[model samples]
Target: MQPANLLLLTIVCVLVAYGVGYARSRSLAMPLGGIRHLKSLPFYYGARAALWCGLPALFVLGLWVAFQGKVIQTLVIGSLPQEMIPGNEGEASLLLSKISNVASGALPPSFVEAPIVDASERLQALREQSRFYMSALVVSVAVLAGFLGWVRIRPKVNARVQVESILKWVFFACAALAILTTLGIIFSVAFETVRFFDKIPITEFIFGSQWSPQTAMRADQVASQGAFGMIPLFTGTLLISAIAMFVAVPVGLLSAIYLSEYANKKVRGVVKPLLEMLAGIPTVVYGFFAALTVAPFISDLAASIGIEASSQSALAAGGVMGIMIIPFVSSLSDDVINAVPQTLRDGSLALGATQSETMKKVIFPAALPGIMGGILLAVSRAIGETMIVVMAAGLAANLTANPLETVTTVTVQIVTLLTGDQEFDSAKTLAAFALGAMLFLSTLLLNVVALKIVRKYREQYD
Candidate 1:
């Protein structure tokens, strides 16, 4: 059976186990007096059975899936003749990719040698065998464990403790997985960034003005000893993000305040959803709007004012990005504002404060931390944005602060560097990881500052 189909069958088996256990518990209880006399609830007995039926089967299925590819590849490679064996990891990967394409019929068998064709056939047979064994083993384990659990269900059993303990471990495992994944990403990027610095100096990367990253692939071609200064990318990022925050913060915060405090229910109901609809629109759509409409408008405006501006400029990208993030700030701030104690508002009003005075003195201070959090989210969204920046602000890593000029961000450069199949050993490819590391650090710094502000306000308010 296919793994997906097997998964469905396993779920069905678990449900069946639950039903059987529940029925058994109820029968045992009925002969005595009621479920109150039992050690634990019938629901806990059913849950314990379900956990037993699902957990071991799922664990076996996971292990099989994880190791199946490596085992199959080893078998196929081992079966090949001495002459056909790959010498290195890269060669092995390429050979396996070709074999996969041929097996999948993307490449004709006639195009490759007889040895590869034999290996592909071997690959297919091994995969089929693995799948058959995996399905049978998983199903058998599920059924056996389920039967044991159902048989164990009795009036004297305390299933609740066992079920709760299992659930706590599961939740802890999930949390650990999340933390491990994050650490893995950080360490991977850090290692690659170290490799990048081995080729390119950290001083140049951090402080130099030029931003080219090209390198000669062959001796026949001219070598451009590429510049890897990241100052321009970071400068562009800050410039655009500042513009976006300037546009988003005041407008979004004020809208939130109005929706939460000043606006009547009918107006709030109508306008709030309309305002939040801005967030649901795709970033690419915003990109198109910035490129087609906002860029041209800004250029014409600049020209009419006797100032020169590029058609594809940071101003256009940043402005439209601000519009896109307005809903994020507005919605979050609105919720936070509403969460401020109603007693605070009532006391302020009863003391003869005006509506605006009450909002300013009582509610807004209490909601400051949450409002800052919303704005920080908007800032992060602006910093990480790529599509709108790509479409509206052309990707030139120029070291200039002019909002009217073309520039790029760290994210845009990372995407450009890592877009195609490239050799990771090259400094050109490894530079993406360096830029990503720097971006990560920059964001972490931003979060630290925001957290400090949040804690200060929270202490006062809480």
Candidate 2:
């Protein structure tokens, strides 16, 4: 069946289940009056009933769907004539795929064998019928449970308090899910990084200068010795991030100040979204602009001054990345600046401080924590950015601070390491995970520090 049809069926089943529960509960509670009329809301009873009835059935449906193809293929193979099974595993797998397609009416030619075709037809029909019956049973049970719960409603139940407690638990569960997902990702990265460290000593990976990752194809072949040192990639990331911050922070902060303190309402309305429009531009577009236009322009400018410049320089990539991050910084800073009580700005103005003076001394100081938070967010964006650096910075990992030279970033290295034909267990491939772990940890640390600063400042204001 099509994905859309499956989705529609599932939704219809859930709604039917909810309706049944609602009706059953109403029927049971008809005789009850006053406080005894309801211990909980009718909707709450329906929801609880639906959860119990639908969750298990849906889980079963999901598991069955996942395993059904494999089970069917195994059964079909066992029943097939031994000679019909292809000699090679790959060929056998292909034949099985063709058989499945034929059964599903996706193949042009109909199968010639009567028994095989009949069995395939019967199996498909059975699966569909089973699913339909399961859905109906699940919905019926849900409604029955909801009706029973509704009949049990009474004045003494304190349903409001119960509902509030249930909501708190639900929120807690959602938070746990988010935290667990993060932890799972971290652990997966850590495991692969550990494997990488096993093959190349941690010291070599960390301190080596060159980064040629090519390995010998054969025992007799001369191998271009791989340099696992990560210093160059790390340095490139830092350099680019620094350039981006330099450009974005000042421009974003100044624009935010103008918007919050000086701009007329009409200007604010037109300019804020226009500034935000920069964020919506795709990174690929920025990459081309950096590579084709900005880098060439910089090289020409440098040549005029008698300094050699790379056609693809770090300066071009970093500068464009900075421009990309400006809106993120400005929009966030604007919100935090505006959030600083207007009364504070007014109070500073009333003391005869000029607008600029008030902004620098009073409003800016008051909003410093928030501004820092925005800067930290921008830093994270700069570090994680991939496309601009990959296109304009070139893939040579150079450990240099000179923006005029080409430098590759951690993200670029990670991309190059895992692309094309790759063995997941190899050190080169696993190195990508190590880089990911480091990136995740660094961003997490920055976010934590920013949050603490913001919280402390918030407490002081309160």
Candidate 3:
């Protein structure tokens, strides 16, 4: 049976076990006087039975599914003659691909040698055998464990403790999985970044100004020189991000203030959704708008004013990105502003302060932490944006602060470097991971500053 089908059958068996255990628990109670005669509730007994029926079978199924293909591939490869064995993991992977393609009939068996055809046949047979055994084993284990649980359900048994303990461990496992996934990402990137730094000096990457990364792939061929400097990329990132924040912060914060404090319910209902709808529009759509509309307009306006501006400039991308992230700032700020105590506003007004004065002196201070959080989120969005930057800001890593000139961001460069098949050992390709590590550190630093600001003001407000 297919794994998905097996999973559904396991769920059905767990439900059946729950029903049986619940019925048996109620029957035991009826002979004594009521449910109060039992040490634990019938619901607990049913949950315990469901856990027993589901957990072991699910564990076995997961383990088998994770490793079955590799195990089968190993067996098939081992069966091949000595001359046909792969010398390396890459060769083994390529051979497996050929075998799979032939087995699936995408590739004709006549094109490959006899050994590969034999391996493919063996692979097919082993897969069939594995599935048959897996289905039987899972069903048997679920049934046996469930029967044991149902038989052990006595009036004096504390099934609730067992059930609770199992659930607690399940929740802990879920939390650990999330943490481990994040650490896995960090370590994977960090290892490649270390390899990158081995080929390129840390000082040159961090401090050098030129940004060319083209390198000759072979000794016989002439190619452009490669440089690994990240200064220009970071400068472009900061320039565009600063411009976006300048545009987003005032407009979004004011919109939030008006929505939360000044607008009536009817006006808020109509305008708020329209405002937040900006966030719902796909970023690709914004990219098209920025590239086709905003960039052209900005260039024309600059030319008319006797100023030089590229058709693709940082200003165009930053402005459109600010418009895109408006909802993030406005919606979060509005919620926190509304969350401020009404009595505080009233107390300030009772002392003869105007609405604006109360907002500035009382309510705004109280909501400053959350407002900072929203702005921080908007800043992160601006820094991480790739679509608008690629579409509006042209892909030239010019080390210039002028918003009118064309520039490119780290994300755009990372996407460019990693877009196609490339050798990972090349400094050009490994540079992407190094850039990713730098970006991670930059954001981590941003978060730390924001947190410090939040704590300082939060303590005062509290």
Top model number, TM-score = 1
Query: Each candidate's root-mean-square deviation in Å?
Result: 2.8, 5.9, 3.4
Q: Which regions of candidate 1 are displaced past 4 Å?
A: 74-95, 107-121, 216-223, 303-306, 459-462
Ten-residue region with minimum lDDT total, candidate 3: 216-225
What's the residue-level lDDT of 297 in candidate 1? 98
Q: What TM-score does each of the candidates earn?
A: 0.90, 0.77, 0.86
lDDT (CA) for every model shown? 0.90, 0.77, 0.91
Give the winner by lDDT: 3
Worst window of 10 by summed lDDT in candidate 2: 1-10
Q: Write candidate 2's Cα lDDT for 283-389 as tens digits.
A: 99999999999999999999999999999888999999999999999999999888888788889889999988998998888889888887997899999999999
Candidate 1: tens digits of C-alpha lDDT, residues 242-337: 888888898999999999999999999899989989988999999999999999999999999999999999999999999998898899899989
Off by over 4 Å in 3: 1-9, 69-136, 217-225, 304-306, 460-462
**Residue 63 Cα positional deviation in candidate 3, in Å, after optimal superposition:** 2.8
Q: What tens-digit string does per-residue lDDT give for candidate 3 at 170-248? A: 9998999999999999999999999999999999899988787778566654335477789999999999999888888
**lDDT for position 17 in model 3:** 95
Worst 10 residues of 1 by lDDT: 215-224
Q: Which parts of model 2 have CA positions greater than 4 angstroms off?
A: 1-8, 23-36, 57-169, 216-225, 455-459
